[model samples]
Target chain A: MSIPITESITVIDTTLRDGLQIEDRVVPTALKVEIARALVDAGFRHLEIGSFVNPKKVPQMADTAELYRELGSLEDEGVTLYSLVFNAKGAQRAVDAGALQVKLVISASEGHSRSNSDSSIAQAGDRLLAAIQVLKANNVAFEVGTAVSFICPIDGPTPPQNLVSILEPLVAEGAAGVGVADTIGNANPRMVRTGTKAVQQAFPDMPITVHLHDTYNFGIANVVTTLEMGITRFDATLGGLGGCPFAPGAAGNIGSDDLIHLLHREGYSTGIDTEKLAGIRPTLTRAIGHPLSSKLSTIPAVPEPAPIGRASR
Target chain B: MSIPITESITVIDTTLRDGLQIEDRVVPTALKVEIARALVDAGFRHLEIGSFVNPKKVPQMADTAELYRELGSLEDEGVTLYSLVFNAKGAQRAVDAGALQVKLVISASEGHSRSNSDSSIAQAGDRLLAAIQVLKANNVAFEVGTAVSFICPIDGPTPPQNLVSILEPLVAEGAAGVGVADTIGNANPRMVRTGTKAVQQAFPDMPITVHLHDTYNFGIANVVTTLEMGITRFDATLGGLGGCPFAPGAAGNIGSDDLIHLLHREGYSTGIDTEKLAGIRPTLTRAIGHPLSSKLSTIPAVPEPAPIGRASR
Candidate 1:
């Protein structure tokens, strides 16, 4: 039997945040603002522009606070700009910037937590509680997401219970939603379904987001599986820009451009301007000083749409 | 509900044929024999080594007849070597070469048929009738396949009825199986599911194989869709080496190496050796004089498998 395509989907553009976080160049705050304007114009209502991490450690996002101040028009348009807050200090920066919403990040696996956050999973999560409190006190809505939620390079595969336990504090702290990040992008469809299903079952009332990478080319397959399971929100980067340290030279997030191409071709409404979306890749490539990893990055012109056989008739 | 991973699947590697046909250099017959030996050693029971088209038209496969004779030992091991025969002349070549099996190819759309085969779809079908008699007379087990079976670069999307009507003659000739090709690699999951299911429903008893390219990064997603629909036979290439003439600079077939990785990690059995499969990329790259398009071709080593959460526990 043929699976019916969902009529519409919500795509969270994380290009300026995760896409450029690990890149060598520090994109000017002006360029970041320009990209955000283009994104909003391209029909992306949700965007992750930067992380509120320590500037010394992540200079790429040092301008995130500045970006928040510069995005007056987008915020006025009721667009959601997500700033990743890793700790209480990061949360304080978002509050200082008057951020409307924040995504608190932690690792689910013990090894990733220790290496990524300089603490164990529990310690890393506990640190988020302080961040959660600051966000709540400041009246800023926040969502908590766990990295390495499915498979960790250091701690092996994460148990569903471990993920649930890790999210319990944030959920208790009144996280508006929970997000699961397949940070290294090695997850298969089965892992996605099982792991995301576990998280959804654990927090029955919370909204969930699925973050994916294309390291093993399983990203889109997992996306299809996620859609088949009725989960809507997805995080994608422009031109597939993020790189996984674990999967060196592998592709980053499934490209938002590529993902939109798939969605539209599959008869799903994403409210994205395909023409405007295609225009962003050139600007992104120039800003990054390199070609992008997404398939669309290499394709100069989009081919005419080919209707499905029976659907056309 | 989550789709159950099939216990096993049949992967038909079209590497030597489709993967190399369009390469700048014609891989020598001796080298092809060596690679074919490696593929067989790597646990591929089904392989498409070459096409029996005219030397004047596709000189890259001028050695197809020789490859058949050279693969005597592999055939003794019961590995099926499929040679593509486009018309009566090509079919005669297969018979002369004592080909154990042949894939008779016809395009489903008139535009692709005119461009690729220099004949209309109906005219191409007429040519295959003579080819079919030759194969049946020679006791050659054969399968029929249609290129541009899903979306035609020239014909837009081919109707499913177009495909069925084209295949009817071959099915009447007692063909062993049928294959549908996304020669342009532009299919989305809906297209893959709908087009494939239509073919399956039309021919209730015939075994079906899906052929795909990765022009728009939809290859693996389409693979997942086909698997979800319970169709197990897949055609892939080593290191994603095939090129789509319709969509140049896009990816070729979904990489056999990548496909095997997905299948194995998803807990599906392919009996294909990942280690041996990984080793093919280097040799394939050297032979082709360039890097391959497959994700696995970029990675230096295979990452250790991360177990699925609940499944592991």
Candidate 2:
């Protein structure tokens, strides 16, 4: 029997934000804008440019507001730019910067919540309520996402109830969508399937996106598993850049180039031109100042001049 | 809503044979025996030690006979050791070395067959027919395997019909089992699912094993897809050791260490102790004179003191 494949999936390029958020060298605003424009030109409509965290804490993303202002022209092109916001203050910063969409992120595990947000999951949720209200007041569209939704570095595996409870307020307040992330790049496919399914069952109508890191080389496998569960959205970074400062052992996010290759090979229409995507990788490589870890970054693209062996048949 | 996982799977460690075949340095015979011994102690019942090919062409595998002699005692312990044979002479060499079992491999694609064996598929099959007769005369159990069963390096994809056509003679000869190899590690899950399903349908009673390379980081994903197709057997190399000399762009076999980690995380029993398996990696690394490419080889094992997250729930 064949896997029931979804015809198409939406890819949100998080290169400028998650891909560069943890890099040692802070990229200039102009370079970031250029990268975003390149991504948009390569057929990505949804892009996460930066997070609205404290500039003092995350210096790399200190220019989020500036980036929003710089990309104001992209908004007219039907581009939906997203920024991460944790509390009312961040939401206000996003609103003040003319942000149209924001993703409210909280850790589902107490351990991650303490380290990443300096609060427990409940405390974080309380803080996010204020952010939701601020986002509502500003009339900015918002979604809720959980960090370490499957496994936690300190607290260990997060129960599905933990995720559901963490998401209660956001889901109840009519968040536009939901996202679950493998914050540490450690969750297996089965965990993703179970956790995502739990969310799918609870909010059947909500658009769900999974953000994964290729820390264990299980990113694509997890993506395949989620696809089996009917998920049609994923978040990736260009040239596989990204890691969380708080998440130990986390590697780069799944490479947009590699993921698109898998999606296309599996007969899923991602509507992104891989050749054009590959063209932008050198800029990312220079921005990160290191060799990118995604498979496509290392290997030259094989020309499909003709189907080899049985593909011809 | 959860993924329907298989209860168990069989892992065949092919490090000694496939992993070391293409290395520039030829490891010592004693080291080969020690590695095989460590693998068996770690609960790997199946191990492919060496191939009975031209020793001059494959100098790294020149110690095949002596290594087999050294490991003869392992047969009494319920360990099944496999060596590859192509022609009647190679089959005779295996029998003379007291090989209880052998695997006859040929490329499913004409492109690979011409390059790897310096013969056409028809010519290779004619030679394999002689080898099969020799194996029967020697009372040695053997199985048939096809390299590049899905995608070929020179040729593109091998149609399912090509694989079936290649396996027809061996199946008619009553081969013990069948193995389909992604010789170049370029196959995506769709190709794997389609090609493997074709083989499975043709030989419903045949036990099939998949040999994959992690060239594109699709090894584990292909494993997951095949598992979903009810494929229970896989071949892997330790520390992700092994690549193809004939197949360009081939990286390493899906690291046995990494594959086992995925299988265990997905709740499948492989009967192999990962800790013990990991212990043997340093030795292989020393022998190979380089670091292994597997994810587990680079990272510390995640302590599963308790199943975290939704798995616990």
Candidate 3:
């Protein structure tokens, strides 16, 4: 029996944040703002522009404050710009930059937490408490996202309960939403469904986004699985750029252009234009100084939607 | 609510026929046999060794007869060797070469038939009538597979009724099983599900297999969808090699190594040893004179089975 899919989904393009975090080339701030502008023009209402992390540790994201200063006016145009904040310092940085929305990220696994944040999961949660307080004090909206929420490279699989337990604090503290991530791109569809279901069961009313990577080519499939589960939010990157420096064998996030193509072809309305996103590939490729890894970027043309067959009819 | 998956699936390795068909280099006959033997050793009971096409048109398959002769003894080991035959002459070649099981292929769409077989679908059917007769006369087991059953490069999407109409004659003639293929690799899961559902309704008793390419990275996802429909048979190529030369933008078939990994991870027993398959990648890479296209071929490690989460527990 064919299951009915959810009617609509919200996609958050994370090209400027997660996508450029580990690049060898440091993209100019103007280029980052330009890509963000083009993404907004192409119908992306939610975007993760950058992270408020130490500039010396991650030079590519050093211009996050400047980017906010340049494009902060787009908030009036119904765009929601999100930046990653791990500690109170990062939260203060977001407030100083006039960020309206911030994502508080903590690793769900101990190994990833240690390497990614230099602390254990509990310690990372403790660190986030300060950021959560700052966001509350400044009246800035925030969502809590747990990285490596499905499979951790250093640790094996993050248990679904572990994801639930890790988000309990943030959910209790009035989180605007919750997101689960397959940080290393090693998760399968079953894992995604299992983990996201746990989070959904725990926070029934909170919006849940599933962050996926294309390392194993299961990104879109996981999206399909999660969509079937009625989870509506997804985070993707342009041209499938970016991998975690700390997560071994991690690949790029699922490409936004490719993801939207799959969504539209499946009869879901994304309100996003595939041709316009595809048109941005050369610019993305030029900025990255390498060809994109997305199927749409490498292929000659985006396949036209075929006629629906008898069974669907 | 999570649905229970089918207990297992049958994976037919088609590396020799579909994997090496479009490569720039002509792999040696010995290497071809070696790969076939390795596939069987890796627990593949069904293998498509080669096609009985003209030497000038497809030089890579010129050694089909020789390969069958070399590996024919494996039948005693319970391994079935399949070769593609399009006409009466190819059927005779299969019999002469000692092929106990053969696959009779016809393109479901008009454009593919004209370019691939130099005939219309009707003419190709008329041509296959002789091959089917020959197979029946010889008492050789045969299965009919429709190429481009989902989407055709030239004709666009082949409708479900078109697939059913093309396979009607063969199904009526006592074909052992039927297979629907995404020849150009541009098919999404909805197309696969829609097309396969129509075929299933038309011939409920005929066993069905799905042949997919990873051009758009939907291969495994389509596999997941088809499996949910209780269709257990699949065709894959080792190292994800091969494409349809007549179909523009067609990529390699779903990688056998990757397919087995996904199946096992999703709790479906394919009886395939992924480690053994991974070990054979180097030899395949050397034979093709290029790196393989499968994700597992390039990835450093096969992700280990992680602890099952709360829902399953």
Candidate 4:
């Protein structure tokens, strides 16, 4: 039987970059490269390997250049390596490190902007536009990521119209597309559908990627709603790694294995073997020295059925 | 602007009974009564207050009779109090405790039956039939609750045909309705819609209640699908209080506040005041000796609009 939905969904694995940011334990540069290789081997088309932020604030991402260099030498032609950049300097650093795509993040909510970046919304927008210009001059592809686009911890619900107001100028400034991040993990499926609908209405042809956190546990549900809305791209972390150090009580991003399982079960092909994805859980657990918060990690592999009754008979 | 969907969906609060069963802490009888009264005050039409089970095994529900008597004496018109029973003896206890409706639970999955009830599926069916006979003889309004009706913890997914097989005999036994319980908290919205549709097809006129747990965090999502299928009656817990003790690692049931919020937002009138429901969270938290697991608990009442300054000012 031909399935209605095929394995056309793009998996953008952000375990090394975003996952390392929120994790309490600092993953070594070598482990980050190993994770990238594993993610590529697991058929991820996109891998966010690291961020180019200051080393003092985010120690886990200090070895970004070394990690990027290792991944760049890997023979995998299917993987498109990317990194996160908060400013023009970071964007320049990412381009120097040989990253094909550099993601620039700006907070849509003013409260989060002040808390996360110590900048106003307009200032952050200006920074993002400048960074996009720099990346363009360097011949690097870039996307403007709007963090806390759905609901902010301090600001509550973000009006969709305000989000559009921020996006229009960035798209004009050579941003390849816009990525909406649920930084506090509060967006429900309904909110996601409504928010995405609003953005899609404003930028009809703009490619949108949704970055979700599982804090309120609506991550996968929101992904399903987005899928129904014809959004085939999303960001997920291995073993559900990563949460914002600044965003208090924010849990990890949606688990990649859990996301794969949900999509596969719903008849949407994600081109991921869930069992193989789950195999990396132990490595993540040992690296973090604590149990990961993924449901799929704990479940024993479903045993195959034995041949019927010959021995008993 | 009038909304097309029905507003006054019936809220059946199942916290005291189903919720208590999943709790590790033994809630006192007074606290159970307090939760039950709070649920009624929150506009719940039906409340499953407690269960008549062996005190030794489920010590949390040791005072079912006292809890029922206290709630019965309130004489709250329009409120229907229910008690869950597992066998004929428990059914008699429920009826004697002045329960307006007595609910009996049996598993549709054979594996769940063996693990949960320590009996084969056939033996459990016989026990359920005996309990039904007892309820019928007393003319007590009764419902047969099929626990793990959607998916079994040990058996994985329960086939729709297996659910039909279980519901058929119960309908024949004059069951007023059958409830589908996501006992292990493993159901998705599609599974809920499919399972509910199958059972409804098998018994056209029978009332159905969808009891969900938030383990995988699809509780409210499944409820939305249930609503799309025109299922108005559902089981919820105040402050998302309960889970199954037998099913390890299951989270609390869908919070009544969150469910009411979703229904009201979708143009369905639940006759529940969102503010009042949120206010009850603290009381439940204090009684449970821990904070409740609801998203809406801390949401400040959506403040009324501030007055605009005069043009002269």
Q: In terms of TM-score, which candidate is strongest?
A: 2
Cα error, residue A218 of model 1, in Å, equals 1.1
Each candidate: what lDDT?
0.83, 0.88, 0.87, 0.75
Each model's total of backbone clashes: 0, 11, 0, 3
Residues A146-261, candidate 2, lDDT per residue (tens digit)?
A: 99999887877778877887787788987999999998889888888889988888888899999999888899999999988889999999878888889778888999888998
Q: Runs in model 3 with CA error above 4 Å?
A: A1-6, A306-313, B1-6, B302-313
lDDT of 2 at A91: 93
Q: After the best TM-score superposition of candidate 1, give how far the Cα of residue B83 lies from its true spot, in angstroms.
A: 0.3
The predicted structure with the larger TM-score, 3 or 4, is 3
Clashing residue pairs in candidate 3, if any? none
Clashing pairs in 1: none
lDDT of 4 by residue, A136-231 (tens): 888888887688887676676677777789888877777777788887776656666767888888888888888998875567767867877888
CAPRI verdict on model 3?
acceptable
lDDT of 3 by residue, A1-313 (tens): 1345547778899999999999999999988988989998889999899999999999999999999999999999899999999999999999999999899999988888888888888989988998999999999999998999888887777778998898998879989999999988888888888889999999999999889998887888888888779878899998888899889899999988888888876768777887888877778878889978888878888458445443211
Candidate 4 chain B, which ten residues in sequence have the lowest lDDT sum?
B304-313
List model 4 lDDT by residue over B1-313, tens digit each: 1125565788788877777775678888877777777767767778887788898888878888998778896545877877888788888887788776778788877777877778988898888788888888888878876888776666666667778897788778878888888886777666677788888888789888888887655677677668768787888887787877666666778888777766664557987776777767777777678777665653334332111121111
